[model samples]
Target chain A: MITIEFIPFSQMSGLSTEQKIKKILKSVKSDKIVLLQGKLKKDEETELIKLTMSMVNEKFHGIEPAIFSPEIKNTGNFLKFLKEKFINMLLSDRQGITLVGPANLIKEIKRDPEKMQLLLDLNVSRRKKK
Target chain B: MLDKIRSALKSLFSGFFKKKKQLKLGLYGPPNGGKTTLANKICKDWLGEEMGSVSNIPHETREIKIKEQILIKSGNKQLTFNLVDTPGIATRIDYEDFVKAGLDEEEAKTRAKEATKGVIDSIKWLDSVDAVVVVLDATKDPLNQVNITILGNLQAKKIPVLIVGNKIDLKRADIKKIENTFPQYKVVGISAKYGTSVEDFYTELFNLVKP
Candidate 1:
């Protein structure tokens, strides 16, 4: 059975933020894809890339979440690392999240996740207009 | 036996008469840096509630998430501290996380820009703060654009800043290296997971606001 945990924002209005994050990182069902994005600083972006790789490497049913970092000053060395991992992660300052996995899991997330979570934890959805 | 009962009754009566005070404190750090965990620990310890969520997912907090006033004590005085948690920040920018969250192209871009603005605003929140605690992951190095920018901003505002080197319990945590990097400030190395060194951290922070 698929496990879905909701982590509230740091405000602590509801779910646990860290547990929510861990769930998002681990909540890959089948062939659905994930993209984690934001205007993150250089270090933050690098940290996420590392987190995503480690999380994906674990046994979550044969899923791989690759990162494409921002543009690097020295393109040669950067490209070499990306090619090694089969991902051209440039290592820039922009914070982004990418997830590709099963469609059913994505649907379940849409049904239960919060808006701020959608913007912060999952992906940002455009539906609620107010 | 009669005296013991009388004393117990007096103590119980005084417990209800105790006054509570709250202090506002801000928790700042980059995305996925474990700032939320530290915040929750302080709150739950004092206020009986979790500080905030600790997540490995970047940008787990997209806005300035504020916790209610937490009543903590400093010496003979009891004060309530308001812990403010904010979104994770970074230099490079991307909207993919938004897209994966299921946003359209135009809206995702707008939200990305708005969230970036929020992070910038949170950094400036340091200026008016009573005191600021910067959470640096011990598993990572100290040098980065966001770190430098934040430190520079705090110094410019003449804010009393404390460095919290969290996750020191991790095997790869290089606490000494972090201290050596930012020698100009007060740094405390602690493992938030084990509750080690938090007392020292709290004391150091309490000393600044003790009135």
Candidate 2:
């Protein structure tokens, strides 16, 4: 059977985004498939990549990260919108779901925009296990 | 002699890197955004089958669902891919919210727990996908947190993305606003529940996955 480790972002509320990302990186190092419940903040997501790239070495494989979130809802009157926009200009409040895994373990990531599906290349993974 | 051997090896190995056999297409959006409905429509149209069940409740698809090997044709163009219908992604999953949606306390909590895990699973599956279709309700505002997060993440990963403005059959559907919000992407409006402009969706989709 296939195994995937689920990591809900909510559960890590006590930790800073950076700390959570560190945990994800550690999980990927172990070849554990990690699913993040909430999406990473823009800066946090960027930092995660920077850290991953800097940390990758002969002992560690690179990570593959993907995120999904719900649709954005536009609401309220002009003044309320302006207030939110002004605040948003200074603070990044974007959030969603994110997942990370070992790049070497996952051979290929194929996406079909029309059908909205994500297919994996399992052959390479099986081959590597041997 | 070395240069000749290197050129020979390059040519011989080139065939091994031929076009991919199948693509992974992921359906993503907020809860109750008609992702499953769209998944069903695609399956019905090509595979002559239904992918999954749908309901009025939110997060109806609490687990990641897959329908493999769908080959869609448009004129001489042929596209083959696997369909991945992910659980609705939410910033928050409150058990009380599920209770309000009509589940009992225990069941609501259970569902909320499962839905929460489902969200994680969907996000995790992202690294395994090649492209994504962001399904949005055409009648709703397109500037919410979840939508922004999805877009930002895809941009970071450099993954090809297409936006689906679903539920156009509804009177309040505003495809233009969605288009304006994400001027960078190809946003196609359709009603997955009623099959409106789905052909155009397919066309746009074909263009989206092109290498």
Query: Top model by lDDT, which number?
Result: 2
- Give the lowest summed-lDDT range of ten residues in model 2 chain A: A108-117
For B12-92, candidate 2 gives per-residue lDDT tens digits of: 777556554468999999888899999999999999999999988888899999899999999889888999999987644
CA lDDT, candidate 1, residue A11: 23
TM-score, model 1 to reference: 0.51
Candidate 2 at residue A6, lDDT? 89
Could you give me the TM-score of model 2 versus the true structure? 0.64
Candidate DockQ values, in order, are: 0.02, 0.04
For each model in turn, which proportion of the native inter-chain contacts is also found? 0.00, 0.04
Instruction: Summarize candidate 2's per-residue lDDT along A1-130 as a digit string, tens digits.
Output: 2347887655766788688778888887777778777667765764565456455543453565666544433585778777766665544333445767676555433322222233444664586679
Candidate of highest DockQ: 2
